[model samples]
Target: MASKANKELESWIKHLSGEDMPVFSGTVADVTESVNSEDSSASEVAQTILRDASLTSRLLKVANSFNYNPGGKKISTVSRAVMVLGFEQVGALTLTLALVDSLSEGVQRHKLTEEMAQSFHAAIQAQQLAKKMGCKSPEDIFVATLLSRLGNMAFWAFSGQKGTEVLNLIQSENLTEQEAELQVLGFRLRDLTVGLSKSWSLGELLDDFLSDHHGNDERHNIISIGQELAEAAKNGWDSEQVAIIFEQAAKKLGLSVDEVEELAHQNAKHAKEITRIYGVTDASKRIPQPNIDMGLIEEDVDEAKSDSTDEPRLTITEDTSTAVTSKYPEPDSNVQLTIMQEITSAIEEKPSINIILEMVLEGLHRGVGMDRALFAILSPDRRTLTCKYAIGEDNERLCKELRINLSNTNNIFHQVIDSKKAMHVPSDPKKLTGTLSRDTLTLLGPPAYLVMPVIVRSKVIGIFMADRNASGRDIEEKDFIAFQQFCQQANMGLTFLAM
Candidate 1:
């Protein structure tokens, strides 16, 4: 019943179904050679690769469909591709396409079933979704989508007749392929895809999408939109219905549906064409142009399908406060996650360690309603904590040269250093000596204050001191504990940096 061309195509592709197909060398070599090129001509060389008619065409189709190439005249030259994508980037892109081609070779293709056409359609739709969403790197969307369904391909290749049965049920049943997969293979296609992605060492983002795409993660959502478009192709869904589904999906994935519709449509068309150029087909039945609403319902249905396999939830016995307790008893998971986030955020915003101290000083000054805040770190010699950053008093810099002896009997710094832990000083500055003991407070200066040592790697590294307004009141127990927690977090951050 099938055409001879289709039968031959299936046989050749089935040869690829072997689990032991040698890693496609041409693709890897192309990427390696590109990377190894002399720096001076890297750009030119990369341009040449993009300029190849076949490669250029593929790239354009991918870019346009992925929704990444800013709309203009269709890109026809490698020079333009190089300029738009850059040299290093062009290498990355070439590598991606090369990988896709190599992997798809041995994949089984039932020629008459139009499987290859559907694959191209899905890939192009994914790229368009990326562009429409204004994704910074829509090329990635193309790559992710192109590779997303490889798991299903490999399943068919290896399982042979059994795989065909699964595919048959998927096309016949209105249920998801994942459900049919469970019936036929006892595991999900996603599990296979993730395994292959890991084995191939694909980029982290792609790996994330492959593993997490069906879930609430955005990349997953984008790929889902691609699949939805592919489904639309089969169902003969009208543009309006497609737009509604697209808009709903875009909102869920934080994309603008109205703005991306043209892009999505273009991408879907391109992916369909590209996959057709190859030899893949969709196993799902095409829905004819169906009318659909665009809104919360779409999101709910999609998300529900994604999370359906999750295990049942059990009651949590721990209270919220106690749940924050450290998983790592010594290092403290709660403290680490908190401090790491703060330090990473601060560094991400402003790339300086001094900025961290400034942040601490500002928080203490305002958050505690303090008149002044001082942050001092011990010199490498361990003699004193030099005032690195401060807020409040104008003479804070004048006190920059200040140091408290680590071994001095009257020094509170010595007590904290000796203990190798936090020591809180409340309302009793007179008990301390030297600069710390300075009772300018007795002269009606800033009244209540607290000082805690910054310990890192079992050694006292710095000291943080905060002075309250001239109210002469004692610090509250809760406030002291909060301050202690803050110091602990700071200590953990500093320790991590030291490592």
Candidate 2:
């Protein structure tokens, strides 16, 4: 009986899939899927989002919103918008708008309105509070806090259960909101939200907010305070619940209660301004101002969850200076994936050194779509790496003669072998003078290339090198990931062949 009950609860979570939601249009879905992919690019995702004219306008409006665009520079295109707002943020915002549109419909209209209003109001509060705290990724916190309640709000909007009954059960039975949810709907709203958040690949930060709730952490406190304050605002500012929440928040923020009050009002003002952008259509039904109805007591915010305030920023580095200096264009992703598949299949059926080496070179050339690729075997004594297989040059004869000594050198190729990590070398020798030697540059056919070491159980065995050569095509993060995965797979095949 217990097992059957558990499955029933899990079913509710399964129903909360992003696919079933009305907001997940194919374009929005594509951006989510693409940005989450290891081989996809911001520019590539931007291209897909651009296909939807309405979505493009929405993205630009938010990107050029007073917050993201401070320089007054006009973001004229979707591609530029994606760059400005960040691909992940753009994707999250797309989902946020769509989700509100879906959940704001149907029977639980009043209840749904309350939840959405609280979520948006709290999100803006968390964002402003986070900024004041010197948090690096305030935007991340804003999105996470807003989405934290997505599961509960979604459930309330969908479950057809009376909100009053759920609330009464929690109070009368002394059951937690999640406990009441399990008894009523067979699953926690958090279960639905966390599951869908991961499926949509919202960001790891949201995952942390949902999963990590260690007490005394500023991030969790910020989320908690945001929720509490939303309820306080709903009840009117001078209510007992609001006073308690403010007292607690004041302690965490190390501010006077008066100061906290000021910030809360300011946050309310901003929230009112951002309702349209955040998909809250009716601004008139805003958070009940503390000033307007002082001491009017209301119930606590229901089934709301916490999110993190700390920022984890990941930088996607592109060589801004080298685009003009490099001569070759980046490899196409489809071609790269196809080539990698072919290499994997060829090596699996025929694990011979020659066959594997040939396929690898072919991948680097035709698969990676690079101009040249070479396979060099490491000597038994680790004395040298000598080019034994080559492709993509007018003379494969000279390509075969290229060699590099194992002696200590500042060049990237040497670093790849020493560090056992693939290294990216773009055009512009002067920029990389700390590593690449003039002689090494002379040997490489292209100004840009990647050198990855092939290893077998930690022992360096051989080298895979390729470049656009004189064309100087700079590698991107996605391209680098593809190249690295190829190297790892090739290493396995080479290891088997060597045995």
Note each model's CA RMSD in angstroms. 23.6, 17.1
**Reference-based lDDT, residue 430, model 2:** 72
What TM-score goes with each of the models?
A: 0.40, 0.52
Off by over 4 Å in 2: 22-41, 45-48, 67-73, 86-92, 161-180, 198-201, 294-499
Candidate with top lDDT is 2
* Candidate 2 C-alpha error for residue 328, in Å: 32
Candidate 2 residue-wise lDDT, 1-499, digit = tens:
5676557646655665543463553444566566678865443465454333344445556666676677766554443345456666676666665665566543454456567778888888888888888877776678778888877677667756445677779879999887887777666777777776776666676777788654566776787778778867776766788888878889999889888888988898788667655535542244666466433323222211111112111111222322222222246565467556656655566634665565555555544656667778888887677876665553244344567776766656677788898877666667563365455556775456777998887798888887765444556666667777778888887777667
The 10-residue segment of model 2 with minimum total lDDT is: 305-314
Best by TM-score: 2
Model 2's alpha-carbon lDDT is 0.64
The per-prediction tally of clashing pairs is 30, 10
Q: Please, what is the whole-model Cα lDDT of each candidate in the order they appear? A: 0.51, 0.64
Looking at model 1, report the run of 10 residues with the lowest lDDT sum: 311-320
Report how far off residue 439 is in candidate 1 (Å): 80
- Residues 446-465 of candidate 1: C-alpha lDDT, one tens digit per residue: 43556788766777777887
